[model samples]
Target: MLMEKVAEILREASAEAVEPRFRALASGEVMEKAPGEVVTVADREAEAIISRRLRELLPVPVVGEEAVSADPALARALLSEPAAWLVDPVDGTSNFVAGHPDFAVMASLVRAGRTVAAWIWQPTTGTAYAAELGAGAWRNDSPLSRAGAGGDPEKWRGVLKTRFLDPATQHRLQTGARVFGEVTPGRSAAGMEYPMITDDELDFILYWRTLPWDHSPGGLLVTEAGGVCARLDGTPYQPEPPGGPDGLLVAADPATWERVRGALA
Candidate 1:
């Protein structure tokens, strides 16, 4: 029932605050929160709706991307708290601003530094992805699972976000990844990428920044779907209350993760 409730909250936020503003945002409604990072009025409004609803559900700290952007201390509180809600009101603000259909509203319930439940709602398609820590992962009414072996390291296809990496590190990764089948900078949305992994559309994604709102939900979804999500150093991906420790690698399975990690290393 809690999962269903969170899913409803995502849908409500999208309906009440997101969809109406898509492609219709005024000049002032979209602005950069930081260099190369954008946020929209929909991001704020939808976050408000989701955060309020989440507090009513558990009275826990509501750590949203916009909220933390406004107050960075909340991120530390999220790490210290016994539980909290992590939200990305609009996962692909740039896409949404440009009238693209890939934006999503995502949220995750974290307990003791681990994600316990998560939801990602694609407003355009009205599709929802949900996962519980040990239960499983689902796309709408269909169960999601890893179905096949990732055959060859050289044949693996994936996304590696290298924009945030330093020049030296970026060059190393780009040059080292030459052996992979096909590599591209992803669509800039973890919400979409996680689903693609579960659905077998991609073999892996290695991200250099591990922001809680950007990854917590997707991490759980990938793992629950029988995939693997870990840091570049092979530790399980854990949300840093203050947010750092780069390099998150998520793949279709453990073998693929190792193969991909080696190719890039």
Candidate 2:
């Protein structure tokens, strides 16, 4: 399966890329990208290595964060391609540049607009999560099952989703349920942990932005892990839809999904 090989490559590349960069930053290197965004040399180097490795393995096209423009037309065309890899070589680049250990390498194989395989590697923690269509999800070598056994939010330990809530939204959630909100160390790791925490007995997770490379792989992991992922509006996730918005909402159990959806509403 694509996930296994991809995971192997990711683990290797992430270690090779992040270790040195982390060291450089420790030695005094300012990291900055856009005016407000931050990036380190590690981001560019990691993307190069990941891009090379992916090209060698599959020889298919890739749309990566550092290289891709925000052109909707190009994104749509790439997603519609029969075979393409969406790569986020260093998700949470801001965190990595800032010496935070919450960044990750993320990739997804999209076919006909649907993610068929996915991989996410947390470089600092040496954790790799992957999944293939119908094959199930795995963290390292261990398999991941759904949270709560049968969509029971109460039985779950934690849940993850979006965090774009306003003050009113937060207040509503507090009034209805006792759910706790946790911000993961990095976006990529947080994305992977969305499904993983459920496997760990967590109740739910919420996220706001859904970058192609970030959520595609993470969403597949949850689905394979026996969980459900969707948009905030309860719509199924479609990476390569002919025309649609770019965002994601996820939950370990259906009950939690509905519960969180209501709070957002």
Candidate 3:
């Protein structure tokens, strides 16, 4: 029920605020947040809408990507809350900014640093994904198969956000990437790529960044679907802000994660 309402919030907010602005920005609809990051009218307006609805759903604190970017202190403060909701108003903003169909709206509930529930909605195609703690993940209403249940991992197909990597690593990985399975990076959108893990399209995934809003939802979905999630060092991943222990490794299973780690290590 909570997830259904969460999905409803994402769907309605996207339609109302995000979709309308897709490739339709006004004079001041988009602005740069950082050198490479951005915030759009769609992102701010959609987060406002979702923040209101999610607060209505539960009285706990709401930590949105845009809101936290404006208020730096919120990031450190959220980790201490008993419960909080993480919202990514318009993930894949660069893609959305470019009119690519990869942006998504996401929400996740974290109780004392543990992700209890998550929802990722792609408004462009009306497709959605949901998962709750200890329960199976679903696409719409159908149950998703556990990892490796769909197909073989020949060469071990996975997602690696190579663009965000160091120049040397990026060049090495992208140029001679034939050795590594040509994974489709999320392009700053976990909601778009995480669903692929559930369907077993991706055998594993590797991400070096530790942004909470980006990983919280997708990580929960992968584990709920019977996959493995951890950092490169084989430690458990806790949902939190950046500036701490980073790196993420989610795979079809523990063995696959280890194999990939060993190969890359």
User: Candidate 3, 212: how far from true, in Å?
Assistant: 0.6
Q: Which pairs of residues collide in model 1? A: none
Which candidate has the highest lDDT of all? Answer: 1
Per-residue lDDT of candidate 2, residues 1-265 (tens digit)? 4566788888787778777776467543554545766666666677778878888888877777766633445465455568877887777776676667777888888888788888888767777788888988888879888754344334434433325457775566445444334423224455446545445545455555566776788788887886778887778776752234644556666766676566545
Q: Which stretches of candidate 3 lie over 4 Å from their true place?
A: 149-153, 171-178, 184-186
**Candidate 3 or 1, higher lDDT:** 1
Q: What is the lDDT of residue 155 in candidate 2?
A: 43
Q: What is the C-alpha RMSD of each candidate to the true structure, in Å?
A: 1.2, 3.6, 2.1
TM-score of every model?
Answer: 0.97, 0.81, 0.92
Candidate 1 positional error at 89, Å? 0.2
Model 1 residue 135 CA deviation (Å) reads 0.5
Using lDDT as the yardstick, the better of models 2 and 3 is 3
Query: What C-alpha lDDT do the candidate models reach, one value each?
Result: 0.89, 0.67, 0.82
Question: Candidate 1's residue-wise lDDT over 1-265, tens digit each?
Answer: 9999999999998999999988788878889999988988899999999999999998999999999998999998567899989999999888998898888899999999899999999988888999999999999968898864458767778898998788999889988888888889998788888888998888899898888998999999999999989988899987776457888999998888888888788
Candidate 2 global CA lDDT score: 0.67
